[model samples]
Target: MYMSTILKIAVRNLTRYTRRTLLTATLISIGVIFVIVFGGLASSFKNSMINVITGSLLADIQIHKKGYVESIDNLPLNIFLSSEETAEATKIISGNPNVVASSPRIKFSAMLSNYAQTSGVRLVAIYPDKEIKTCPDLAQRIKGRKDLSSIVNPGEILVPELLFKGLSLKLGDEIVVVATNRDGAVNGVTLRVAGYSEGVMGPSGKDGYIHIEDATSLLRMEIPEISEIAIKLKEFKYLSSSYKKLADTINGDTFEVHTWEHLTPFSTIVKIVDVLILMVRVILTSIVLVSIMNIMMMSVYERIGEIGMIAALGTLPRQILSIFFLEGILLGLISTVVGAIVAVVILTILTITKLEFKFGSMNIALTPGIPWSEMLITVTIVMVISAIATLQPAIKASKLEPVDALGHV
Candidate 1:
């Protein structure tokens, strides 16, 4: 028989059992939907976390003195760049045409007391004018006091509501902070709760913010110094090249460059999301493979006498095998196309609806963003697995003897 005749026969055979063919295709398409939806949600979540972290305080890039990152938990002010070194580093960073802004931070660990109760807290003393520009989310969320720009009043401090509730401290309340200075001398400072600020980080709820000058007084150094400098670029895509230019311009021995991901522990969450995506695809593919194989096997079994008759009439066994293979491929193509379209429609609706939730301290919106590459990969996996799954059943039909197959009840 001609190849055209064999293809026509395959189509006719598939059309004879419309429900079974539709059911098999639906199963394959469902797998595509799962992969696409999960891929989109994971990507959206990672992007949200990045925005929250960077918006809170971490700019596109950070410059730290050598050994600061390793000993950061200890509040290692000893490893910081002194006033003179900070000036030189600032000049190098600000020289890059891509650089947009920069701010210096002195982070330290200190104990706070309401005079009635006491708790340990992570304190950051930052320049208000510079911090407000890139972290506007925080600027908009400030409550309790009219102004947060001036921390010059030694006794004023900013605390977030998360900690505000825990401390049982109210606005206009006073808190005392005590800490060991860089020289190992214990020093104390009194601060009045001046305003409330918010942060996306889980720890930010209990963290305290004060003026850089006050931090200088608390951490006590003869010379002014900062733990790190945060730099914002015109576009984050230029981070690598911009970092290289700044690094080469500065003394490498004294300064090290880091992106936001390297500076924060949040990268671990991004990794876990990625792993879940991979595992999900693996599991979904197995389900698809089994469904397609079972459907094809039933197709071959129900038509044993038909296969025998076709073979007896001189239709090649290879042709019989081809028929089953073509049926599986056709089902895969139909389902993949339909599934992709359905997934896209649903994702579009989700984006418009703006489904949002807060995970930990970060507010994340399920922004509908499906990668075209991921969609293509999903279709390819379904088609390939569908073809592979039909092999055993196709081979069984091909190997059948005409006499026995003809006798099949």
Candidate 2:
């Protein structure tokens, strides 16, 4: 039989049972919509997280002592660079044109106390001037103060809003911060509460800031010795080149370079997203398989007489098979196209309204638009499943003896 003849019979047979065909097609469409909508949402969330984390805490790249990261939880000051080593590392890093700004930090954990309450806090000592240029948003999030430009006093600190609210803290409150120094000696500082700022999203792990000078004095840090360097690039496009370039130029086994993704633990959420997508694919594919296969099997039973007549009239068994296969493929194409359009329209509306929600401590804005690649892959899965589901019935119909099918009621 001609290809056109098989298609005509397939479409005609579909229209003969209009309601059933529509129902099956609708189920497939729903599955497609589920995959596309959920996939788009996962992508949007990851993008929002990346923007927030990379913009502040993670920056673009980081430099740290080789063994320091492996035992980062201890705040191991012993693994840190010496004053002369830090200066040399700074010189090599600053030589790169890709570097826009770099800031040195000393990160430590301390117990902060006001007379009435005490809370354990992570403290990041920053060079206020350099950090301001590096993270401009930090300047904007300053609550009580207009900006972070001035060093009002030596022991002033900026607390996160969450911690501030929990501790019932007020500006100009004198607080005591206690910690163990690198030499395993007890150290403490009485610092004035400066102001509050929005918390950073990534792993700088600093809920509060004091001047680098203040930290050095309090912790007895050597001159020019610091914990790590946070680096920003002129453009994000420079990330790959700069990471390799800086590593080669620094040329030291004592230090390791890392990107923001490696620095922030939250980045592991990307793997979680992948697992979710895979589960979704399995669910939607199951829907297509069961729904299409069930409908096609019913179609075979109802059309047995017609199938017999066509075969008896000298139409080949392969031709009979082609007719059913074409019907399933056409149904898949129609449903997938409709479902994709619906998904795009809905996603667009949500994006335009700028729908947002908070998950845990992070705020996420639902970004608009789907990646065409994701949609294409999902539709392809539906089509492949449709082919497989229809194949079993198609094969059964092809093998049916004309005399036996004609004898059916």
Candidate 3:
């Protein structure tokens, strides 16, 4: 028999029991939908978390003074670049096409004390104009403050809302900040709380910000003694390339470069969640594979007499095997198409309706949406698994004795 005749016969045989075929295909479709929807939602969640963290402060890459990351606890007061190095770095970064913008920042741990309350906070002295350009939230949240038009403005600062709440501070309240200078000398300065900003990070929400010059003068550090260089990029995929280029151009002993992934440990935890979600999707796919295997096996068994008759009537054993394999392939293709369409429709409806997610202890109001790329991948994986699952059954059917198979059926 010709290959086309065998395929036609196999397809017709599949259609003969429409209900069973439909059931098997439906199960495969369910698995595919699960994988696609979950993969998409997980991706979205990770992206959202990244936006939240980056929006609050840290940019895509943070270039810190050498040894600052490793020994943040015992920060070396004088471990920073000179004026020339700072100018050089600024020039290179500003010139790089991949670099969107860069801001120089001075970091220190300090205690903010009021009449009735005292809370420890990390103090960041940032270039206001550059910070506003990259982080508009900083600009938007400024309240009870004067105009901020320069990097070396006299007395501008941003404090987090939590700090304000903890100290019962209203706008314009004078807060005393005690910080250690570059020479390990403790110095205190009084700065009016310029504004209170909200943050996604706990520490950031608890900390305070001061003007570049005011913070430098208070900390008694030279204007060139910036501790970190925060940079935003045109694209995140360019992060590694930009970082490598910057590192190569600068002396490694003088500065260390880090991406947002390294700067914020929270992103790492989110990545771990992504891995777990993928593993769950694989497990679901395996379940579908097992179901497909069982469907193919049963299909082969039920058609033993037909297969034997075809083989005995001058059809080659290999051709008989090919027929069974073709049946599986066709079933998989049909399932994939149907599953993709059904999943898309379902997801669209759910998205339109704004499906509410209510897990055991979490209630999140978000769309359960899947992207087209994820849908395509899910369909492809399901089809491949289905084809692989049918291989053993195809081989068994091909090796069967014609007489015995015909007699049993």
Report every candidate's CA lDDT: 0.80, 0.81, 0.74
- The worst-scoring run of ten residues by lDDT in candidate 2 lies at 197-206
Identify the leading candidate in terms of lDDT.
Answer: 2
The predicted structure with the larger lDDT, 2 or 3, is: 2
Provide the global lDDT of candidate 1 against the true structure. Answer: 0.80
lDDT of 3 by residue, 19-67 (tens): 9888987877777767776766676566655655554478777777787
Cα lDDT tens digits for candidate 1, 113-229: 888778887787878767665454555456677765643245678876666767888888878889888678999988888876666665456566888878888888666688888
Among these predictions, the greatest TM-score belongs to 3
lDDT of 2 at 46: 78
TM-score attained by model 1: 0.81
Candidate 2 lDDT over 181-241, as tens digits, reads: 8787878889888887666542223478888888888787668477888888898779999
How many clashes does each candidate structure show, in the order listed? Answer: 1, 0, 0
Which residue pairs in candidate 3 have backbone atoms (N, alpha carbon, C) closer than 3 angstroms, thus clashing? none
Candidates in order, TM-scores: namely: 0.81, 0.82, 0.88
Once fitted onto the true fold, the runs of candidate 2 whose alpha carbons sit more than 4 angstroms away are 83-102, 111-119, 129-141, 148-155, 162-168, 174-180, 185-191, 200-206, 231-253, 257-265
Backbone clashes in candidate 3 total 0
- Which pairs of residues clash in candidate 2, taking residues 3 or more apart in a chain or in different chains? none
RMSD (CA, Å), candidate 1 to true, equals 3.9
Error of 2 at 120 (Å): 4.0
